[model samples]
Target: MDWRSVDAALFDLDGVITPTAEVHLRAWAELFTAALPPDVAPWSDADYFAHVDGRQRSDGVRAVLASRGLTLPEGDPDDPPGARTVHGLGNRKNDAFLTVLHRDGIAGYPGSVRLLDWLAGRGIRVGLVSSSRNARAVLGAAGLADRFPVVVDGLVAAELELAGKPAPDTYRYAARLLGVPERRAVVVEDAVSGVAAGRAGGFALVVGVDRGVGEPALREAGADIVVTDLADLIPTA
Candidate 1:
């Protein structure tokens, strides 16, 4: 796909920019398994790949509970950090994720860096658009926070009342932050929900980095092009 028409790029954080993706998966697994009742089976990888990977924290908790034929009250977002409700579960996951991140410093995806550099060199404005509230911290730790001049992360999403991935709001916000129209921006994602959001936003290009999910899955999710790595895109400079 030709990205020439795109003047800006919006990127996801966990899997797209940093190795925190694995940390998220692990934390989810831990939280889900611990939350399961004594008689319930443990959380599986398929459960993660199917229900939670790309969703918001509260959404992820709800999805996993549904998988086990369970339900919980839609607790308030400010529900004190550990109250046993949906928000509580989400907070627990966040705590676990932060622990892992602090222990293991962020790792950058070489392919992603190459693509970001290429875009920057070509004068294409770039922004980091992620559902994670810790997007800034992750990028800062990885020494990449300065790479993108504009950042529209979970905090921005909350402030703008924008829905997360699969709703097109976050990507649209990022594009807006870059002062580019949706049709003139590219959204690069690794999650099914994120690619769908990009496509729904009518971006000039919806590129998918199929890190774990196969290429066909990404294509099916509305990615214009699926590449194993962003390095495949030659540097415009």
Candidate 2:
């Protein structure tokens, strides 16, 4: 990789920098397992990859329900959990995620930290762009909040009226906030939709981290390169 040409690195919070994606998967499974019709297949990881990963929370709930051919009202964001509406399910999943997160805590991948340190040594600015509203909490719990000077997450997206992943607005916003041009910014992500967003935004490079979401899917979505871990990108010398 041409390290000199890269001015900034934008990372996805869940699967890339931390393993909170697993916690999210567990939360999603719990929500769907209890909520889906008994005849519907039990919620699985594949459903997450296809419909939930890298999407806004409410949007994910809507998509998952649509996949089951079950439609629900677009409930208010403040609706109580399990209210038989889209936001309710979204809220429920968030609540479940928070329960596990606050109970057990979370941490960043060692390899990811290595890469972050490498970038710091090189003066390459770093930012975080995530679909999850919990990005701040996750990064804080993982003790990585100080690494990123710029963060663009679900809450920011809603406040600024920026589109979510599978769209590039959030990434673009981060790059802009980091004071870097897209052509000199690299995006690291684990989800197909995220890589697709990088591609759509015409960033310098879109890096795919194959953390359960397969390499082929990420490549198809336009990842310039794929790696199993961020440490693999560090200079061997």
Candidate 3:
């Protein structure tokens, strides 16, 4: 399929564009390990690719917890960032991520940059939709904040009461922000849930970046095209 056929490109920020995705996974693993038990299998990259990345913070926390045959109360969204509940734990993970981001700074996925530049240069509208509250800061730190003309992130999601991944709301919002019909926009994602959301949104294309999501798994998630990286989609010069 030709990526250029789409009128606009909607991307998930973490694994799809930013190297900070790994930092997020590492922080999540550390936080989950400390909160859970040593006997529990540590959260692996595969697990993160499947369950955590691209998901909303509370949803990710719930997914990882469920993997351990455990459940936590769905604390109010108003719960303080560190109030010792499920929301608190999610906030803790965010804090860890911020520490890593501040210390290490931000980095972009080269493949993603290649694709974004190609898309932008061709005059295709581009937008970023992420389930992360820190998406703006991450982009700013990475010097990619202005590359995307539209950003619909976690804070906006919360403000609009949009459901996270596996729900079409976030991607739909992005398409609207880009002033493109959903059928004319493509959703580029690296997580299973994100692909599901794109499919549910009826996007013209769902390009899955199999960064850690195994090839077969992404195809099964309804990705219209599955590649190891976004560089695969760049039009040849």
Candidate 4:
């Protein structure tokens, strides 16, 4: 991966660093299962890969509903759960996620943690870049709050008025915050939209961690390389 050329590394939160993607997928399923009608196509993991993964909560809500030929108003962020608005559904999903998170705390992937330790040993700056607003909570839950000095999640993105993944703005912003130029930073991601964003940002390299999204899709989405696990990237003596 031309590690010698990289000055910083940016990682997507849920699938790449930790298994929180499972929690998020369950939340999304719960929201859509209750929202979709009996005759309509049931919510499936495919919907998650296609519309929800790597998107901001509200954007994901709109995309999933659009795929089902359903439209909801862009309700305020404070909209109550099950209120039948974009933000409401997003909030409902968040509620489900928080419930699971609190019930069962998260942990980072061992291989990913090993890579982080290896990168630290090499003195490379690392940052967490994610579309999820709950990134901070998840990072803390995984007990990795200290590993990343710079984080550009949904909250920071909104505060900076940056666009989310599949747009490249968030990834670009993370690089800037880390004081690393686009050509000197590496982006590691597990979602198609995230791969596309890294590609659009013209980073040094985009590594795709295939959790569920297939290799061809990630490669087509602009991943420079694809591996089943981050552990594979570590060199052995």
For each candidate, the alpha-carbon lDDT, in order, equals 0.84, 0.93, 0.86, 0.93
Considering every candidate listed, which one attains the maximal lDDT? Answer: 2
Supply the TM-score for candidate 3.
Answer: 0.93
Report the candidate with higher TM-score, 3 versus 4: 4
Clashing pairs in 2: none
Across 89-202, the per-residue lDDT of candidate 1 in tens digits comes to 888888898998888888688978887888778898889888888888899889998898888887888888889888998888778777899988888888998999999999
> Ten consecutive residues with minimal summed lDDT in candidate 2?
36-45
RMSD of 4: 0.8
For all candidates, the clash counts are: 0, 0, 0, 0
TM-score of each: 0.94, 0.98, 0.93, 0.98
Per-residue lDDT over 103-172 for candidate 3, one digit per residue giving the tens place of the 0 to 100 score: 9998788888988888878889999999999999999999999998899999999999999998999999
Evaluated at residue 210, the lDDT of candidate 1 is 81
Model 4, global lDDT: 0.93
Clashing residue pairs for model 4: none
